[model samples]
Target: MSVRSLPSPADDPSTDIPPPPEYDGNLPFAAAGPEPARTGGERLYVAMTGAIVAGPFLALGVGGWLLWGRLIHPADLLLALGLYTITGLGVTVGFHRGLTHGSYTARRSVRIALAVAGSMSFQGDVIGWVAIHRRHHAFTDRPGDPHSPYRYGTHLRGQLRGLVHSHVGWLFRNERTPADRYAPDLLADRDIRAVSRAFPALCLLTLALPFGVGWAIGGTWTYALTALLWAGLVRIALLHHVTWSVNSLCHLIGERPFRTHRHDRATNLWPLALLSFGESWHNLHHADPTSARHGVDHGQIDPSAAVIRLLERLGWVRDVRWPTPDRIDARRA
Candidate 1:
């Protein structure tokens, strides 16, 4: 969780801006660089990444067609909503807020359960997800940030390209963050390590659960298939884009009411607030990285904070870092 690796901001006279520190940069964002030839293993990696990204999208189209045919079942929508809430909270409340930032301390069992739930979100293993996120905070919008929309420089063409890069293109690149460096604490925890290793099993379980439930509820393979499409693939696609929008759109278009590090342009994009579980309250999050509550403003909807509060009431978590008014004022832009 240590972000001390972040370099101090430097001044660039031409743009009156600071440049990001150098790191293992992606070739696509490297100015005037040629794309490197991919080895077989690298090609396989990209292929798998492509399938993961494209499959959910394909399901979305299929689901829409099924919907237009008036063949979509009520059960399918219900299951999709249920799984979306569970897995989305797992990412926002568990992986991002709790583990990544130490916003609260959960009971050992609750902690492990949350990690398992988050792993089921198809977001990557718990440890790796936390590591990459921590690295993003450490270098946010700078050279080392894994998904910065400003990677290509701030011109019209670059902005458009960076948008695509930050949204999903970065996933196709070979930008591996060292978990040992950013997530050593989780690496040391036996329970978390166990959950991390169970990632693949959890992934299969995530899909199979919907399929089995759909069959049980509707007693037909067609029901199972539709459920798998809506609840499994389509749900994942929605969550993925919502999360990626926090990386891309949140930085590009919204109110920056809170101050962040130089070159960190995280913003509070309200349109994504509910879908992203209040994670689109990006400006405040960057300003106060460890706060348990992101939507501290009045009337701002933060379902993840509500979930955390319920957990606290249930004695599953404590030492919550609820933002105070004074603390909020101090970070105002």
Candidate 2:
């Protein structure tokens, strides 16, 4: 070309100059991205707790007028006791020890059975239960512990309030331990994750199953309705209190025979032993989290341990972490 070409923007040396700083596209004091949205799950959890608590109070008012008065039926009492035992053991043995703690393995069939039975208790999905429990162990009586009774203080009034706080009030709170942090293993398990997601359906079945059984047994609508009240609602309420007591009463008022950190006030309350499937041996549990047998001493009467033994005998479970004499002695205070 005869004419000299003007310097294009890209070819020009001055074009390399940095652009002027502009506030149009960015904030002067901006930090990173916005925080995550709070889940509405806590509202649902609070509603659930309220319903469970209110159910018992209402039942007591009505049932006292009906059952405890001249209309009492022994079958109702028996049904309550029987259902409580069945579902209580399902939570303690099947959910806590077997699923959450992995104290012992189970056959595929036993695993499925325990999952179903535990779901019938209406506590929660296996994964959520395990997640909260694992967090408790990871931060026993500390800031992150899900239901530490000592969160209030050491004074009598504070401790009393804390006891109630830990026992049942904590369930109404919105705070939740992260599933990824505490229960990644369970979260990764397809079966456990699925079961956890089916919690509402399982709870519905928990109520309905007792009603169906009562109908079959008594061949009457009244019997079925009464059974649902006693076995389903009352049983759930009672078990809820007993289990929550371990987190509250067991920690606050028992003999700490097994040495542990001062902050970890886990103790064995003998009165709750039989009813809790030997979980009242709390001192030994904190001392040795992996032990399949919590009631390690003679005459401790761990029904759960007995069941584990039977399962092991049948080759349904292996590699059980049973307590040894040395281990027990080492943990003695």
In model 2, state the lDDT of residue 204.
90
lDDT for residue 145 in candidate 1, whole number 0-100: 80
CA-only RMSD, every prediction: 4.6, 16.4
TM-score leader: 1
lDDT of 1 by residue, 1-333 (tens): 322222211111232234434422332345526778899999999998898899998888988888899878999999999999999999999898888888888888988888888898898999999988887887788677899988887877888999999999999997778988778888888889999999999999989999999999999999999889899999999998899899999989999999887778999989889999999999999888888899989888999999999999999999888999999999998
Cα shift from native, residue 304, model 2 (Å): 1.0
lDDT for 301 (candidate 1): 92
Off by over 4 Å in 1: 1-36
lDDT (Cα, tens digit) per residue for candidate 2, span 1-333:
100122222223442233224312111212225744646776676687788777865766666676665554567678778777777777877777777677777776777667767877767777778778776776566555678777666667768777888887777765667878656766666776677788888889888877888888888998787888877777777777778889998888988889864357888999989878889998898887767899988788788888889889999977777989998898899
Candidate 2: lDDT of 17? 38
lDDT of 2: 0.73
| Among all candidates shown, the one with the greatest lDDT | 1
